[model samples]
Target chain A: MSETAAPLAAPLFDRVAIVGVGLIGSSLARALTHYGVARQVVCADRSPEHCAKAMELGIVERATTDLAEALEGADLVVLATPVGAFAEVGEQLGPLLRPGMIVTDVGSVKQAVLRDVGPHIPDGVHLIPGHPVAGTEHSGPEAGFATLFQGRWCIVTPPPGANEGAVDKVVTMWRRIGSTVELMDANHHDRVLAITSHLPHLIAYTIVGTASDLEDDTKSEVIKFSAGGFRDFTRIAASDPVMWRDVFLNNREAVLEILQRFTEDLTALQRAIRWGEGEQLQDHFTKTRAIRRGIIDAKQA
Target chain B: MSETAAPLAAPLFDRVAIVGVGLIGSSLARALTHYGVARQVVCADRSPEHCAKAMELGIVERATTDLAEALEGADLVVLATPVGAFAEVGEQLGPLLRPGMIVTDVGSVKQAVLRDVGPHIPDGVHLIPGHPVAGTEHSGPEAGFATLFQGRWCIVTPPPGANEGAVDKVVTMWRRIGSTVELMDANHHDRVLAITSHLPHLIAYTIVGTASDLEDDTKSEVIKFSAGGFRDFTRIAASDPVMWRDVFLNNREAVLEILQRFTEDLTALQRAIRWGEGEQLQDHFTKTRAIRRGIIDAKQA
Candidate 1:
């Protein structure tokens, strides 16, 4: 059935406060408006320029630097800032939240969200941490689009014994915004993301780093010839610096764990090459090809 | 000046033979026809179906399975087959080559080409090994297009003491086909490609393999959630299996050398992650970002 065929119930929340007006935050605001998922959308950004631009773009009904002012009269509040700022934002919003209100976030790292944002969510104020598992290399308010979440996965991790209604409402909101919602524990979410996103970003950044360190002439040639394999790494490395910094800081455990495994595998492959073990190299390559096929069969490729 | 501004003084060869009508071979055939670089383009492939399709698609003037027959009367012969088959094809074509004939190839690994085919080249024949650093994920005759080489580098590694005129003519042909030509020793070309191309492919294949070994449910989720990072690996892994196998087999030395460096770097990153070395991770990531910027500045990103 078409997504819009869902019963046209009254807007889920009276006012939705989006705390941050960057790419992910702004995209959420746009999708919420496009789907009429909330009665009103207000935004809070540390950057006054971003707040002004978001308001000018008409993505949110109101934009402000005052977090409490934006949260006033809002039934749903989304902490859309970088993970590094979540604890402070959570503490600031905690005092202002009413009994029936719900709090959540769209951060890349989930366990850190629970640890940082959970304490500030007062009793009877439900908290559902979520990650939409989607984005482009671009950032900022202007980079967001209404369909940013379309056909993507939105993972929600509500603490045990938390309000089911609150989780369902958040899931429904993501569905309205054209996302498939999956419920996962926050720790599991961190591990999965470490492999699927964090490690990839790290490797891309490293290879690009290696290239950057080359001498001027060689470096220029590296870029000129980047279309071979390096271009893809460049795209991944182009992601928002502050946001990624926060991700690494928050999800330290899982990212590190998977990174260890990746390193071991990489080392083994290296030895095979150094030792001129053609069979080992070919065997590994052949095995990897099967994984690619699996991904294609799953419609991911 | 427009590429078509200059007309050829005369045809370089009466008939140009291309053995193996895959993406690269068929593409060369198309470019030869489009630019009138050759008098007639003849193709041969081990797959009868490919030969038939090449003829049906009009990618070449004639298609055949008999390598010796295809080499007849051809002043220029291009070995478009995988690197693994070069020795066999070289031996067959060596005796049939008339004086003043030029034999070149479109292979990824240059040193291997010299090792396998250099000895077979008769005294009067010229052997210029070229690699056009361009391709899509697709393969086979039907996947060929004339513009594949446009704005791409085509490295020509002519053996030392080889005919300078022959090298010039091969370079001219590549330039006319819309490729930027660079001359380097075959060994150096192999080393550069090992870092830029071969090692990246190996890593991609390995990571995808690791994902494939995950539990069934996790594997499915991986594919579903692949867009975040895994999609790029899938594209690389989907490349022609036989061609890649041949590449690994032929360029064993250089590919192995670079693979070692990549592994060492990967291991260091892994240890940092396992030990929660956030600063080290951040430093590496920051360094990599500079490379990405370099690529962009060079217009390769």
Candidate 2:
């Protein structure tokens, strides 16, 4: 490993293990190599084909199906698999983790991370759960690029009494790869994400599903004339199915809570439309427009 | 007016009058000028400032508040106002239209166009209602550009037995301005748009409305973390309020119909989430994924 780390410079991990070489994992590998954030990235995947592809694409220094082998010498282990796999991966990696090693993850649902992966971490090992609020509709190793995380927010939910040095190390690595890291509690992160990410995705999937159930001709026409607003839902609905499925399953309570509110709001809007209440419809639409402006002002739009 | 009209080339009208100088209308004027689709473009707006802005921005050759003056000597009158104003605009322009003139509109809802404007056309004149399935979230003359309609679909719903010459003129003009025009009945257009555009916008507005009602601190956090999925809805909700309000009001029947289906589907998903039916959620989400692929294949995503 390179040893000339300055006070503010990013410290290179001797070996970094990235579990599940999908879009997020492969993207982290690419960014680490591109920025020299780590000396070596070693990836392990359950699918041998994905491991072969990762090695062939040169996204990592080494690729293997043996999780223990991949984590043998790694100072930083990032579990980039779907949240549903966190418990199993954590159990597998727990016995192999070395003292002073940092364990992080890129899971959308944060509370699940603490619940699933927290208990398995050994003493002296840091557990920093992160959610990089960035992605595209595409998935897999081939779909990832080094610039995927640039100018995006990465929320880190480090456990209480966690090692500050380890958290700062993970933050520095993310910063080196061009992400703004923000710290928040896992529960708050889950709730905020339920509204902003999970609920929106669920609604998009539902709308697109409704459209898909239409007659063939009408469905074709919907696809043809999607430039209106349905196309946006289609894009969001196309995101990685496994990841989203795991998201809904893991973050069930928060998702169900927000979805209940969405349903009530939609039902009210539906009644207003049916009764031709133009004033009410216009009022709600106009109020929503203000929130949109605030998002643009916040530079997140 | 320039008289160098080739059989299939050159200006389709001596003068084209646009009733509103917002994004769609201004973009149409700019495109007409850029492609020489009309010899002169005249604009009228309820706001005197908008008219002046349109003229200053060179989106129209002439601007006026008097709908009568704007329609003077114009062989083609385009009612580019909100759908809610079609009836009033139609009534105002009915007596001013010259014989054999073509009256059209760029509104999202088509049935309302027929219901409001169909009776206003004078003998020997034609009403060819159309909607260009394209636009950004921005509004006003300054937000428009000459190439806004390039490669987009424009649906024209000409009345049965309408003047063939007028239909051809509108089709030729749209083609020259970089739109692929498709002819369909007005009622069918409304039904198709209800599913594709109106319902999606209504849902987006409702979801964003839900987010807006969050507590002040949570609302601010939602805006900051909006890049996840809420950002897309914010952009959609940021669309012109008056225009969308008009859409929901004008296309009440079909909007309510499609909205009913969407709400039912959302309820099913909500129930699935509440019951922790992972398979049900996965099945629906997976099915929706294909529709997105179809949209991308159709080049609309």
Each model's TM-score, in the order given?
0.91, 0.95
Across residues B76-166, which tens digit of lDDT does each residue of candidate 2 receive? 8998888999988888888898788888888998888889988887787788888999899998888998889889999998888877887
TM-score of chain A of each: 0.97, 0.96
Task: Tell me the spans in candidate 1 whose CA falls farther than 4 Å from its real position.
Answer: A1-10, A56-58, B1-12, B47-49, B249-253
- The alpha-carbon deviation from the true structure for residue B261 of candidate 1, after best TM-score superposition, in angstroms, is 3.6
Winning candidate number (TM-score): 2
- Candidate 1, residues A153-173: lDDT per residue as tens digits? 999998899898999899999
lDDT accuracy of residue A49 in candidate 1:
97
> Per-residue lDDT for A207 in model 1?
64
| Highest-scoring model, DockQ | 2
Question: Which candidate gets the maximum lDDT versus the true structure?
Answer: 2
Clashing pairs in 2: none
